[model samples]
Target: MTKGRSTTWQERIDIVQYCLAHQHDYHKTADHFQVSYQQVYQWVKKFEDGGQDALKDGRGRKKAPEELTEADRQKLEMKKMEY
Candidate 1:
């Protein structure tokens, strides 16, 4: 299984849907999609938890202050305090 394979947002959504349609079989989904089993599992879980929007890639994306969760804001404050 290929690890860290880069897939488009649509591809992730398709994989998640396929996995769900096939009874959440991560191994079969991964094999069919040429992605790692872990990727299939994580994508399906993300889809279930947050719907299709969660399948979007978040790499190199930054959240605005208002968008940050309480724990994230606290961690940012702690980092600033250390400087």
Candidate 2:
């Protein structure tokens, strides 16, 4: 969404979902999502405090992680597990 980062909406949603499902364990969520713990925590905070709109990457605001989408990340992990 930003110049260097390309975080997707689904990724944001998935991150928040995973964190919520895991009882808001930032470190574990971060590890499972392959992102920084702080990122997971911030996403949870944003999701909880602002809902879906908050996860949106607003222009002129701080950028989120720029890597694989949720599906891609999950697929990659599945592939890794297969190997």
Candidate 3:
């Protein structure tokens, strides 16, 4: 992998597979993949519970629009008129 900090989904899966084939040895997996032991453990757990989908970033996260009060709309209209 490059010097970039983030790893790709495929890379995570490969690491998980290696760990699994090695009898779930977290420490060896981490050392072999240049990652933390905890990371290996979490990835395996996520993979087991949710398959590859769980390994993706922002699994359930979403950006929601900000809620605006009526007063906020009035202020926006005033600002538009001033422009």
lDDT of each prediction vs. the true structure? 0.90, 0.79, 0.86
RMSD of 1: 4.0
Top lDDT prediction, candidate number: 1
Query: Where does model 3 exceed 4 Å of error?
Result: 1-4, 59-83
Q: Please tell me which predicted candidate would have the highest TM-score against the true structure.
A: 1
Candidate 2, which ten residues in sequence have the lowest lDDT sum? Answer: 1-10
Candidate 1, 15: how far from true, in Å?
0.3
**Could you give candidate 3's per-residue lDDT for residues 1-83 as a string of tens digits?**
21325789999999999999999999898888888888899999999999998898985765333566777777877999999
TM-score of 2: 0.62
Q: Once all C-alphas are superposed, what RMSD does model 3 give against the true structure?
A: 6.6
Q: Is candidate 1 or candidate 2 better by TM-score?
A: 1
Give lDDT: candidate 2, residue 59. 77
Error of 3 at 44 (Å): 0.3
Q: In terms of TM-score, how similar is model 1 to the real structure?
A: 0.71
| Candidate 1 local distance difference test against the native | 0.90
Question: In candidate 1, where is summed lDDT lowest over 10 consecutive residues?
Answer: 1-10
Candidate 1 per-residue lDDT over residues 1-83, each given as its tens digit: 57677889998999998999999999899989899998888888899999989888888989999999999999999999999
